[model samples]
Every structure is written in C-alpha cells, then in structure tokens.
Target: MKRTPLYDLHVELGGKLVDFAGWEMPVQYPLGIMGEHKQCREKAALFDVSHMGQVILRGENVGEKLEALCPQAFATLPKGKARYGFFTNEDGGIMDDLIVSNAGDHFFVVVNAALRHQDIPHMRAHLDEVEVTEIFDRALVAVQGPKAEDVVGALCPAARDLKFMETTVAPIDGVECRVSRLGYTGEDGYEISIPEDKAIEVTRALLAHEDCEPAGLGARDSLRLEAGLCLYGNDIDQSTSPIEANLAWAIQKRRKEEGGFPGAERIQRELAEGPARKLVGIKPDGRAPARQGVEVQNLQGHTIGQITSGGFGPTVGGPVAMGYVAAGHTEPGEQVNLIIRGKAQPARIVALPFVKQNYKR
Candidate 1:
C-alpha cells in the first residue's frame, strides 16, 4: 500500500492505520471515531487527503472542451471557482465523481483515489489536444468545521474571503497552495493542495493552532454521510446513475438541456421520466446501526432496497443511513424495515442529510 506525505505525522499523532484505496491511511486516532467526529462538528479538524488524485488541464478552449466531457456546464463556471460533478459512462452510470476548479490558466481536477488511474486515461482519450498533467508532486489536506475559517485565516488571511466553491492559489506559511473553500464534511472548510515537500510544514502550521485537531477517515466517512454526500464505491458506482443517486442537483440547467455528455440521452431521459429507484435517508427507531448491504424491506417483508451506507451518527444521536428505495416509497415519513441480524428493524424514510449542512456560501 502507498503512503501519503503525512504518514509520518499520522504516526506521530498515534493514528490507527488501515488500508484504504491502495493507501495505508489513518482510520482514526487515539481520540477514536466519535471523538474526532465531534471535534470537527463543534470545532475544527484537519484531514490528510493526499491520496486523492489531482490533475491539471490546460489548453485553448479548455472550458468548452471540458464541458463536452463533464456532465456540468463548465463554460459558465467562472475563473477561480469549483464545481462538483461526475464523469458518466455511456450507459449513464457514474464513472467517478470529481471536483473541478476553473483556474485562470488551467483547470484543476480532484478525483477519487480508487478511480485515479482510470480517470486520467478516460480524460486523455476524450480531451484531444488538451494538456493533461497528473500532479503527483502535490499533497492535499482539508481543514473543516465551523471554526475552520478562523483557523485557516490565521495562516492565510486571504482564505477567509473565499466563498464556498471558490478556489485560489494562496501562500500558507510560505508554502504556495491551491486552496479551495470546499470539503466533503458539509462544513465551511478549505481543501489545500501544496507541494509534497511542503506538506508537513503547512500541516504543522495549521495544527499548531489550538482550534484544529487531526481527524481520520473514520470521522471523514461519518461527516460526509451525515451531510448526505455519496461515497463513490458504497453509495454510488458504475451501476448507479446521477439521477438515481440523488445528485441531480449537480447537473446544471444548460447541461441537462443540451445533452452532449456520454450518457446524456439516458440521464436526460431519467431526469424527465424519473428514475426507478431514488436515494433516500433512513432513520431507524433504535440505535442498531444498519450497515451497508443490509436489506431494506417493506412492512410486508418484501425487499424494496438495500442500505448502501449506514452507521451511528454521533451528531444525529441515532442510527442514520442512506439507501435506494422504490421511488414511491422515498418520501419522508414512509415506513420501511431494515433486516438486521435476521430480524426486521422498523425505520422511516426521512429527508436527506440527517443533519443540516453548514456550508459558508
């Protein structure tokens, strides 16, 4: 397994290491998952996300060329701004979800670690004449939570002014970083891309601040799950379409109307006709913590869907889960049963994001 630039720091902090997406990363620290989860929610937490893939796309008509490949309307994306969308395959299934920022001279892309290799080849094959460079020399880190702004602002005052979904190259403690005010935690935070050599320096500077704590993948998963964000392989995959994944909001009006992407026909058709199944939030009556692959059944014991991501939400104060159910049974307050340990546990369909998102727009 690979190691990120912050592997040494993680070890110093007594993080529990685990294999994730071909990388040996910290799953949690001595603080544990719940402790780290609360730290990010109530205060600030820093995450080592260097394992994620980063690429730079530069060339003439970059926006126009990129719009053809992505499902979002990249042409309208202003410079120094970021947008979240996925690369869809020909069958309308999600190839991979990505975050793309439109820098002045080039577009910066961040893809899932698992799909990093496949994503680059797909882009190079489709984006003819575009210079696609994989940036392996840089390491990525995310500072997230309610107090993230103040913690990061102390180091780079310019970051405080960047609105959500905005990106800019800024200097933090003399380390030049491509900073984006975005994160998967559903909190007001910034994702910083810095030189691999400077990663430890930048991280130490941020951690020295009293407001920040080191969080691991355990907390990261719970935070994003509570935010109703889909985990690439768990909640969404090549077999899931954006429409069915409840990510239709990411598809702008122009892209939905123009229909030029790989699965435009099927995606647009699903948009108009509605998908057969829809992703919905499930709140169980008790705290059994319905896990992934658990069968979701109707009141009559008929299986309707399956739990994709489920766990005990430290913030939600109960078991929270997100899964796909028959469209008709997706509305909030609808009753369902989760087959846990061979017994059916009563649950109700609730609106997504068991906890409300706190993005600083």
Candidate 2:
C-alpha cells in the first residue's frame, strides 16, 4: 500500500494504521475514535489527507471545457473561491465528488483518493484542450473544528480573512501553501496544500497549538456521518444520481438550464419529476447502532431501503445514519425499521445533519 508524506509522523503519534483505498492510512490514534471525535467538535484536529489527488487545470476556457463533464457553475466561479461538485456518468450516476477552486490563472481540483485514476483519465478524455496536471509533490492537511481559525491564523495571518468556500495562496512558516477554508466535518476549518518535504514540519507546527491534535479516518468518518455528508463509495457511487443523493444544490442554476453535461436529459427529467428514491437521515431508537448494508423496512416489515452509512454520533449523542429510501417515504418523522442481525429494529427518518453545520459563512 502507498504511504502518504506524513506516514511516519502518523506512526509516531501512535496512530493505528490500516489499509484505505490502496494506501496505508491511520484509522485512529491513541486518543481513540471517541476522543478524537469530540476533540474536533469542541476544538481543532489535524487530518492527513495527502493520499487524495490534487490536479491543476489550465488553458483557454478551462471552466467552460470542464462543464462538459460535470454539472456545476465553474465558468462563473470567481477567483479565490471553491465549490463542491462531482462527475456524473451517462446515467446521471455520480462518478466521484470533488472540490474545485478557481486560483485566478488556473483551477485546482481535489478528488477522492480511491478514484484518482478513473477521475483524472475522465478529465483528460472529455476536457479537450485543457492542460490537466496532477500535483504529486504536495501533501494535503486539514485543520478542522471551531478553533481551527485560531490555530491556523497564528501561523499565517492572511488565512483569517478567508470565509468558508474561499481559497487563497498563503504561507506557513514562510513556506507557500494553497489554503482553502473548507472541510467535510461541517466545521469552520481549512485544508492546506503544502510541499511534501515540508508536510511533517507544517503538521507538527499545527499540532503544537493548544486546540489542535492529530485525528484519523475513524473520527473523520463519524464526523462526516453526523454532518449528513456523503461518502463517495458508501453513501454515493456510480449507481446513485445527484438528485437522488440530495446534492441538487451543488448544480448551479445555469448548469441546470443549459444541460450540457453527460446525463443532462436524465438529470433534467429527475429535476422536473422527483427521483424514485432519495437520500435521508435515519435515527435509530435506543443505543444499538445500525450499520451499512442493513435492510431498512417500513412499519409493516416491508423492505423500503438500506443503510449506507451508520454509527454512534458523538455530537448527536445517539446512533445516526443516512441512506436512500423510497421517495414517497422520505418525510421527516416517518417511521421505519432497520434489519440488524435478522431482527427488525425501530428507526425514523429525520432531517439531515443530526448536528447543525458550523461553517463560517
């Protein structure tokens, strides 16, 4: 398995290493999943996300060319700003979700680590005349939580002015970095792109802050689950459409009307007429956790859907989950049952984000 630039640092921090998307990544640390989860919620936590792919797109009409592949308003995206989007297949199913930032002279894209091969090739094939360059010399680190700004701002004062979804070229200890004020943990934070050689130094500096500590994948997954965020392979895949995944908000008004992307027809149709199934939050009663692949049944014990992501939410103070269910049965307060271990467990469909998002708009 491939090791990220910060692999050694993670091991030194007592992180339990595990295989993730062909890379040996830290799943948790000595603080454990619960401790790290609460730490990020109440303060700040640093995540080693160097395994993800970072690509630079340039050339004439770059955003226009990119529109041919996905449904997003890239052409109109202002400089120093970031937007969340995904690649859709001919069937309107999500190929992979990504974050795109307009860096004035070029566009920077961050894709899921597992789908870099598939996503990069797809971009080169469809985005004609665009220079697609992948950056292998940088290691990505995310500082996330309510106190993230304080920890990061102390190193680079310029970063404090960046609002959520904003991006800027800044420095940490005089070393250049691409800082984006965004994260998946539903907190006010930033993802810093630093040189591979300086990754450990920058990470160590951030961890030195009183509010910042190292967190791993275990806490990352649980935090995103509580935030009602979708995981690429688990909550969404090639089989799930953007509309069904509750991500229509990411499709800007112009893209929705122009309809030039791969699955425009199907997406437009789904927009006009709702999808067959919709992704919604599931709240299991009592303490038993409902895990992925568990069948979701209606009150009469009829299978209606299945859980895609589930776990004990440290912030929600209970078991939280998200899954796709029959569109007609997606209303909040709707009763359902999760088939855990061949037995029916009572559950309910609630509004997404068991805990409110804390983005610094």
lDDT of 1 at 318: 85
Compared with the true structure, model 2 gives a TM-score of 0.99
TM-score of each: 0.99, 0.99
Q: Indicate the residue-level lDDT of 53 in model 2.
A: 97
Can you write out model 1's per-residue Cα lDDT over 118-165, one digit (the tens) per residue? 999988988879999998999999999999999999999999999999
Global lDDT scores for all candidate models: 0.93, 0.94
Residue-wise C-alpha lDDT for candidate 2, range 1-361, written one tens digit per residue: 9999999999899999999999999999999999999999999999999999999999998888888888998988899999999999999999999999999999999999999999999998888888999999999999999999999999999999999999999999889999999999988999999999999999999999999989999999999999999999999999898999999999999899989998888899999999999999999997999999999999987889999999999988899999999988999999999999988889999999888899999
